[model samples]
Target: MDSEKLIHKITEKKALKDSKELLDYVSESGENTKEYIRYKTLWAMLQTGNEMDEETINDGYKAVKRNVKGRKSSLYINVVKYAAIVVFALLGGYFIHFADFNNEIAMNEIFVPKGNRTSVVLPDGSKVWLSNGTKLVYPESFVGDFRNVQLEGEGFFEVTHDKDHPFIVNVGKHRIKVLGTKFAVVAYPDDEQVKAELVSGKIQFDIHLGGTGDNYKSLMVSPMHSLVYDKTSGKVYDSTIPDGFYDYWQNGVYSFKDERFDSLATKIARIYNVEIVFGDEELKTRTFTGTLSVDDNIYTLMEAFKIASGKPFEYTFESGKIYINK
Candidate 1:
C-alpha cells in the first residue's frame, strides 16, 4: 500500500493487536508516514495520561529515531522537544541566566544628533533625555566608589535620588554633583562654553578653574539659575533665567533675549543639522533678540530669521547636509 493509505489504516486502528506487526509496518513506511504515526501515538499517550511501557515507547520512537539523532525531525519530534524544554523550565533545575546575556563592555559612545531626540536610563537609575548633537559616554556596568558619568554637548537629567550613591557629572574640567535634581546642561565643545541650567533642587559645582577663589565665584546655582562656563577664559558666570528657558529643548521653540547672531546660528546649525553661510560680515555680527521656533523646518526658520533681521538669505539641502547663502 502507498504511504497515504498506510497512514489512513494506522489512524483507523485504536491499538495494534501485535507490537511486532506495528513495528514492521513503521520500519517499511516512508519518513513522513513514520512521523505522522509518531505524533498520533504521542498525542494518544498524553490524552490517556498513561506512560507507555518500554516496548511500546521504543517501538513508537524507532520510526523517527534517525531523524531525531540527526536533528532532522518533523512536527512530532519538534513537539516532543518543546514539551521537554517546558518541563525542564517549570522544574527550575535549569534556566536561562546572565551567562547567556551580554557581559561584554560596550565600547562605542552613544550620540543623539540635532533634530533628533532620545531617552535612556543610566546604571544609577537616572533617566536622561539626550538632545541633538549630544554625546554620552557611560560604561556597560558602573563600577567604583561613586556613580559617575561623562557628557558632551547637551542633555536633560531626571536623576533618581540615592543618598548612598551620589551622582556626579564630568563636563570638561568641571564636575556637577547632586544627590537628586532635575537639571539641563548645554556643553558643546565647539561652542567654546558649557551652561548648566538648573530647574529645581540644589546643585554644587567644583570648579577646577582658577581665578574663582570663593565658592560664590566658583559655585552659585539655584532653582531658575544657569551657570555658564567659558572654556577659553576659565570663568564662570551665574545668571538668573526664567523658567521658560528649560522648556526650549522639549518645545523646540527658543526665546532669546539679546542673543548674538553667531551664538544663535551655532544652535540653529546643531538643531537643524544644517550649515548657515552669511557672506555679510555685518549680518554675522548682528545680534538677534526674539522668540524663534526651532520646530519649524530649515526654510521656515530662515524666513523667521530674515523677518527678524530683514536679511535676504537662501539655502539648499544635500545628502544629510544643508548649506546657506546670502
Candidate 2:
C-alpha cells in the first residue's frame, strides 16, 4: 500500500486487513517515510482522541508479534522492531512532537519593515507588537502543549492566558517561556547582546550556550526585570528596568538609560530606516540617557545626538545613509 492510502486508513480508523503489507512497507521505508508516518499518526490521534486502554495496547503488541512469530528473516525482525514504535504512535501521541513536526500546521510570518512598526493578534487572542526590522513566525493555530513562536529582532508580547499550554518564544540562542505574561524581547542576530525584559508576571529564560540541550542555563525572570545575555562572553546578568520602559517604543518614543551610542545606533538605524556611519570611533563610546521620538526626522534626531555629545558633531545624509563625524 502507498503511504497516502495507509495514512488515510489509519486516520479513518479502519480495521487492519493488510497488516502484513503495511508492515512490509514500513520495514523497507526510509527515515523520512517513518517520520511521516509518525507525524501523521500523531496528528490523527490528536484529532480523534482515540485513547487506547492498557489491554488494547498490549493486544496491538501481541498481534504484531504473532504476525512475525515464525518468520526467521532479519527483515521480519526489523519490521517487528519498528512496529512497536508505530503502534505507540498510533495509540498514544507520547513521542517528541516538536513545533516543526506537524506539516499540516499553517505558519504565518510577519515582517515589520525597517521604518514601520506593526501589531498582530494571534489566533489565540494574544497580541504582539513587532518593532521595526522584526521578523516573527507563528502558527495559524497552536497545537500540542505549547504555543511556540520564533522572533528575530525585537517584539513585545501580551500572551493569552492558558495555564495548561505555555507560550514559548525562540530568540537567537535563548528561549523565553511564559504563562500569560507581557514581556519584551530583543535578539537581533547581528547584535552582541540578547535581552528579555519582563513587564508583568513571570518567565523562564534559557540560554543555550553551545546550541545543545545539555549545555544550557535557566534563569527565573520576575516582573520588572531584565535578563541580559552577552553573546561574546557567555555571561548572563539580571537587572531592574523602569516601570514603562519596555512598552515605551510602541508609542513611537524610545527611552534609554545610560545606553551606549554604538549599541543604540542599531536601534536608531532600524527605526529611522537609515544607515548610520560613524567616522569617529570616540562617538561610539559615548553614552546617553534620554528619550527620542521616532516620528522625528533623521536631522532632528542627529541634532539631539550633537547636544548629548557636547561637541561639534556634523552629519551628512546621502541616499539613505548618514555619515557622522566630530
TM-score of each: 0.61, 0.67
Per-residue lDDT value at 61 in model 1: 52
Give one digit per residue, the lDDT tens place, for model 2 in 1-326: 64445555454443222355544454554554444445443433333222334665567667788766564565454444345445754443233222342344535565556766556566577877766787877764678899999999898888999999999999865799999999999898888888999988889998897855657688998788899999999888889987448446456777888888887888789888889899999988888888876677878888888877866778899999988888
lDDT agreement with native, every candidate? 0.59, 0.70
What TM-score would candidate 2 get against the native? 0.67
Residue 284 miss distance in model 2 (angstroms): 1.2
Give Cα distance to truth, residue 53, candidate 2, Å.
Answer: 57
lDDT of 1 by residue, 220-276 (tens): 578888988787897778888764675675666677877777677877877777766
- The global Cα lDDT (0 to 1) of model 1 is 0.59
Flag regions of model 2 displaced more than 4 Å: 1-102, 243-247
